[model samples]
Target: MPILKFPPIESADEQGIVAIGGDLHVESLKLAYKKGIFPWPISEDYPLAWFSPNPRAVFDLNNIHIPKKLKKFINNCSYKITYNTAFERVIRKARDIHQNSIHGTWITEEVIAAYIQLFREGHAYSVEVWEDKELIGGLYGVCFGKFINGESMFHIKDNASKIALLSILSNIKRADIKYFDTQMITNVTGSLGAIEIERPDFLDYVANTTAEKEINFQNFSLHLDFDL
Candidate 1:
């Protein structure tokens, strides 16, 4: 399959369906994200569709709400969260859990390979959870500029995914990142502080936040103490 090149996304209101066919190759994936594009298909056999949706769902890095109960769980839970420790395992778990969801998953094997390649290049990252040395949950995503576009999350234990999310958000805040793109809104993300903005508003935020700074993936670290 050939690599795809998308046209200029129409308008912020058009939901940014830039292209509809492509191979999920590493170079293509990096190019897509640098331009604010991402691949999402219904199944492995479907042509890969790229999008930069209008009204993107986002979380302000400093505003990620840790519900009182979740905070309590984090305070007392013995689970530990780490970054980039198990990227392949995290994606596999996300794919498995997504297959059980109503919307199914667009994370095809090709998609997996592309992201793992990004992981190796320091553009993609995973937040992993460990409980007594057992992997319990995690999330993965691509980072560019001041934004980390969250792709998906999954848990094998109660509240484990939330812990990973909280840890990621805390790290972003510590690093003074400004935006966290959730891609789309879902009840799960909403409960964790994600909110939808009009397309214009989202682009405005992205422009303002990313204008003066570049996000350096190599500098990101997840080892800081989380106060939550």
Candidate 2:
């Protein structure tokens, strides 16, 4: 059976490895996210690892910064953005993109299978950008209670993922969820307003945040506004 609990968040090393050697079963994943942790497979040496990083990277919904040029492009773009659609396709594309990149990839077949199960269980979702009815760019993540932890994103065209991110942020803000966890900062996310907060503050936020009913991303549609 998958372990239902993990080590105390404070026990994590400077690298933020709270625990190692747990299966990515839905029950375990759900518990990990509740305590502000998530899985990261480091290498073949470690089957699976759980992490809760200090100075957690996150986006403040009220302060998301979109470049002016990107905003203009977003306003004029013909792409269609949809939520909870083509999730498998999105993650697979993200995997392929990573696998071919210089950085390699962490989304192994095992990881994909596990997250696909999570998606089926309604704890994960994808936001896709379609152009000419062809999938071009997208992102995926796990959502529990009011917390959304972005996993990865891919784009076949310029600024496509940015559009999807802005759309999700707008909708999430409207739903009253004020933060989006990015785990670690990347150039893409950092340029888009992801900031770091102390681990304890992040845990406290997660502890106080909960939703009796899940936000239905399926009913969500794209908003054309670029003022976000």
Top TM-score: which candidate number? 2
Tell me each candidate's TM-score: 0.86, 0.96
Task: Quantify all predictions' global Cα lDDT against the true fold.
Answer: 0.76, 0.86
For all candidates, what are the clash counts? 0, 0
How many steric overlaps does candidate 2 have? 0
Per-residue lDDT of candidate 2, residues 1-228 (tens digit): 778778889999999999989787778888888899989987656679899999999999989898888878887889988888799999999999998999888898878998999999989999999999899999999987778878999999988888888888888888888799999999999999999999999998887674436877865657657434
Query: Ten residues in a row with the worst lDDT in model 2?
Result: 219-228
Report per-prediction Cα RMSD to one decimal: 2.8, 1.3
Q: Give the TM-score of candidate 1.
A: 0.86
State residue 183's C-alpha deviation in candidate 2, in Å.
Answer: 0.8
Give one digit per residue, the lDDT tens place, for model 1 in 1-228.
445566775542365677878778887876676666778876776677888887678887656677878767776778877788899999999999988889888888877888998888777889899989899999999875565777888998999887787777777776777678888978777888887776667656655654445555455455435643
Off by over 4 Å in 1: 1-4, 11-16, 204-228
